[model samples]
Each structure stands twice: as structure tokens, then as C-alpha cells.
Target: MNKKYLFIFTIVIVIFAAFFLLTKKPQQKNTDILINGKKLQVELMQTEEEKTKGLSDRKNLCSNCGLLFVYNQEGFYSFWMRKMYFDIDILWINKDRVVDITYDAKKPEVDEFESPRTIYQNKVPADKVLEVNAGWVEKNGIKVGETIVFK
Candidate 1:
């Protein structure tokens, strides 16, 4: 009787564990960006909701941290400083190659929150746009022709 009860307990535990695992949501994949032989930890903004909230309400960013905005096709996209506290470097990227660079985009003034926002746009169309800390482009030797490999 003891062995039979133990077997039933084990089966119950396995069933509960399987049910718990199956009910859990799938985890999202992390976006890894490698540029100029350097790997950067990035947050991907694939959906419109995520892209619209790009780096806003942030006070600072760590070194080598990036916000990657992904699009379906290469097109002209305009960005504006909404609620950022520090400056950022915006890069226009098409696939693995860099298309353009907008260095040191200034932070918006808190006093001017009700005023017109400053728009930042690149000259060419880009399938992806990368936003990093200001001066990161020059410090990391990132150039327009450099390829960014995503993993």
C-alpha cells in the first residue's frame, strides 16, 4: 500500500508540473547586435507600440546598450525627442549595413514639453534604426559602411 501511494504521488506531481509549464507564456527572444566586431546588447522594437515608445522616459542608458527599431521595409522615418533626459546617436541601417548616422541628438527641454518637438530624420530610407548613447558612434569607431550583424 505504501509503494502504491508513492507511485500515485509521483504521477500527480508530474501532471501538475506539466500543466504549469504548458500554461506559462513563451519567452521573447533577445536581440543581439554586432557592429565593427563588437557585440551590443539591444532591445528590439518590432511592433508599432514598442517603436513609438523608443527610449522615451529614460534618464540614462548604459554603455553599449542600444534600442533597435525594426521595420518591414526601408522607408523614411522621423524620430522626435519626447521624454528623454540625455542625448542619443541615431543610425539608419538597411539589413546589415549602415545607411546614415545622426550624431548627438539633443534631449528635449522639460520646459518646452508643450512646444513643438524636434524631429530627427535621416537622408535615406532604412529598414532598421539603432539608438545608442550620444558619442557612442565615434567612441566605438562605428561608421556608415560598417555592417551590423544580428543574432
Candidate 2:
């Protein structure tokens, strides 16, 4: 009788373990980007909702951190500093090369009517856009034609 009870307990434990393993959520990996051999840890904004809210309302961004917007096709992507708290530099990428760069985009004031907001657009069609802290372009010496690699 004791042996029978031990066998049942073992079966129950194995079943629970299997169930837990099957229902467990998978962990997400970090996405890092390399531009001109310099690395930047990025948060991907793939969906329209995510891209719409890109870096807005954030008090600050890390020096080596940025938002990477991935698109389906190359387009003239326009950006505005709406609801932004800090300045940023926008890099327009076509495939793996930097096509255009918008430097030192200042944050817009709360009163849009009083302080007319500036809209920054890529000089050429681009498939991806990277928004990093202001002066990042000059500090890193990133220029058009520089290659960007995703890791």
C-alpha cells in the first residue's frame, strides 16, 4: 500500500511539472544595434501605436540608448517633437546605410500655438528611424553613408 501511494505522488509531481513548463511564458531578448561600429541598446517600435508614442513623455533617454522604428517599406518619414521632454537627434536609415540625419531637435513647448512646433522629415525615403539624445550624431561622428547593423 505504501509503494502504491509513492507511485501516485511521483505521477502527480511529473504532471504538474509538465503543465508548468508548457504554460510558462518565453523570455524576450534585448535588441542591440550597431552603427558605424558603435553599439546602441535600442527599444524597438514596430507597431504604429508604438511608433506614434516614440520617446514622448519620457524625461530623459540614456546616452547609449535609443528608440528604433522599423517599417515595412521606405518612406519619407516625418517626426515632430510633440509631448517631448528632451532634445534628440534623428537618423534616417535606408536598408543598412544612413540616408539622412536631423540634429539637435529641441523639445516643443506645452503651448503649441504660442511656440510653433518644428516638423523634421527625412531628406530621402527611409525604412528605419533611430532617435537618440541630442548631439549624438556629432559626438559619434555618424554621417550619411555610414552602415548600421542590427545584432
Candidate 3:
């Protein structure tokens, strides 16, 4: 092989190795939640970091994977595409565990979609919010008045 070609091959191999070593698999923690007496095994996003990173950059979500957000007070809440890479369905819940509303959140794109100078709106009022893969709620037939218990 020519010396120049050999050097290029070596550089490519080094770059590939660096990329493989620098990328880490995301850690998924588990928690249990009950919906109308039916238990669901879900991944927990309890910490500030985890909550902030909620579903962002994830190429896919497991069938039952979800993020549960616990708020200090009940009010109209909204979420934005922000840094998200995939679309999600937001399930808004009140203190009584009743499903009050559902919103289809937009998927994040490569370009910035949020307006920097304006306040964005939330789709529903809620004390607690559950985010799942887009269409999960409809596919599972989850509806208003359904109750959720976190365990």
C-alpha cells in the first residue's frame, strides 16, 4: 500500500475508535406505576438531570417506558420540544389521580424550534405529568378519568 493511503487508513481507524470509546449507553432506571389497578413497569426520571434529559436523544422508547413528573402544585402545565428528538404524548393529571388532559408534544428537530424571547404555553393544567412515546396513550386506550398511582 502507498504510504499516504496507509496513513489515511490509520487516521480513520483512530477516529472510529475514539468515537466508540467516547459514546456511552444511557442508563435506564426502573419504577412501578399503577393505572386503574393495572401495574406498569416504567423507567424512572426522578432526578433533576434525568428529568431534564427526559427522552432527549433517544432513538426509541421501550413499550412501557415513560417519564413521570411530580410537581409541587397543581396548575396548567405545558412542555415544549426543547431538546427532544422524538415526539411524545403528555398525560396531564390532577391531585386526585384523574387524567385531566392529554397533549401531543412536537418532536424536536435538528434546528431550534423554540422562541427564545417568548413564554411558551402548556397544553393542559396538571399537578402531575406523564410523558410517553407519541401515540402510546391512544394505542393503549388510556382515557380521561383514569387514575395513576406511583409506587
TM-score of each: 0.81, 0.79, 0.63
**Candidates, ranked, lDDT:** 2, 1, 3
lDDT of 1 by residue, 63-136 (tens): 97989998999999999887788899999999889999999999888775434378999798899999999999
Which consecutive 10 residues in model 3 have the weakest lDDT in total?
113-122
Estimate the TM-score for candidate 2: 0.79
The C-alpha stretches of model 1 lying farther than 4 A from their native spots are: 1-23, 114-116
lDDT (10s digit) by residue, model 2, range 17-76: 999999999555348989977899998888799888888778999999999999999999
Top-scoring candidate (lDDT): 2
Which model is ahead, 1 or 2, in terms of TM-score?
1
Task: Tell me the tens digit of each residue's lDDT in model 3 across 19-53.
Answer: 98889666657788877555667776667686666
Q: Which scores higher on TM-score, 1 or 3?
A: 1
> Model 2, stretches more than 4 Å misplaced?
1-29, 113-116
